[model samples]
Target: MIEIKDLHKSYTSGSSKLHVLKGINFNVGQGELVAIMGSSGSGKSTLLNILGILDEADTGSYNLDGVPIKNLNETIASRYRNKFLGFVYQSFNLIGYKSALDNVALPLYYQGIKHSERNDQAMSYLEKVGLASHAHHLPSELSGGQKQRVAIARALASHPKVLLADEPTGALDTKTSYEVMELIQGINDEGKTILIVTHEPDIAAMCKRNVVLKDGLIIDDVMINQQRASSYV
Candidate 1:
């Protein structure tokens, strides 16, 4: 579902140019659950941004679901992002004033889906994430796990080809983390392509494949026996 080749990225401050991704090559197949593991300055976040089409690589190639991604104007990029990618972040990124349902419906709203249809679709996604009963609750009214669940529902509501999560379990306690992972696993089981960026070993182990990054390079990529998150949950 995704491909990258000879990816290179850099940023400049004053006269110093810091190369964040250097000659990177990577790929994620359809229905694959992959974890991107890296430490600070490893360029995993930069890689994720490129993969999400939020940023452009200085030099390289990225293809998402057979579409080339490069130098897209903001309007085209936004359209492609809505068509191809869904994101879940550590902070949840839900609007403070929007209820869980409204938050999930936001993406559909941007897609020009009518209110009743978007609400219905959002509720179904919330049900999938086990948050249907709390659909009307504000982000502030939910627990950390519940808020994350709402975020996941919001991401799924867009029906994107791939789900990209950065530090999805970073803010929660161990139990809550496992619960969230369990939910993620269930989604992957249904054939959703997922890429999770996590430093936690246990969380990485839950994914089918793990890609380790160091100093802007993929130092290791391996497929392991998937450890079921449900077992941990």
Candidate 2:
């Protein structure tokens, strides 16, 4: 559902140019869960930003669901991002003053969804993430895992075609991380394409496929065997 070709991105600092992505090429099919793994300063995050259309590449072609994204103006990019992409950040990025339900409903609010319908949809996503009981709780009151669950719920509330997650399990304990991964796996099973950037091997291993990035290039790609019987056991 997503295709990127010869992607290159660089930043200019004084007389030196720092290249973040160097001719990266990758394609993610619909319903596939994939991980992009790389070390610090390896450009995985840059690639994610470009893929999400938050940042444009210096040179490359990015096509999401057959729509070319490389040349989109800010207005067009924002619309595509909101309408087709869902994002989860390591920081959870939840507004401090908003309740869990409110935060989850924020995206739909921007989409001009009716208040009552959006609230119902938001609550359903929270329930899917096992956070139904905490719907009214504020971010300050929730634990790290709970907050991340809320973030995931918020990402899923829009029912976007692709989910882009950056270090989704970075701040949680092992058990909580597994729980979050399980939630992600559940989403992927339902045919939502998921692309995650993470440094954690275990988390990457949980995905159906992995792509390793280095110096802004793809160095390896592997398909994993899904442990279907043990997925829920």
RMSD of each: 0.6, 1.6
Q: Which regions of candidate 1 deviate over 4 angstroms? A: none
Q: Write the per-residue lDDT of candidate 1 for residues 44-143, one digit (tens) a residue.
A: 9999999999999999999999999998999999999998999999999999999999999999999999999999999999999888999989999999
CA shift of 136, model 2, Å: 0.6
Q: What TM-score quantifies how close candidate 1 is to the native fold?
A: 0.99
Candidate 2 steric clashes = 0
Query: Which stretch of 10 consecutive residues in model 2 shows the poorest summed lDDT?
Result: 224-233
lDDT of 2 by residue, 1-233 (tens): 99988888999999999988889889899999998999989899888888888999988799999999967889998899888999999999999999999999999998999999999999999999999999999999999989999999998888788999999999888877888888888888888999989998888888999899888788999999754423533
> Which stretches of candidate 2 lie above 4 Å from their native place?
227-233
Highest lDDT against the true fold, candidate: 1
Enumerate residue pairs that collide in model 2. none
Candidate-wise lDDT, in order:
0.96, 0.90
Q: For candidate 2, what is the TM-score?
A: 0.96
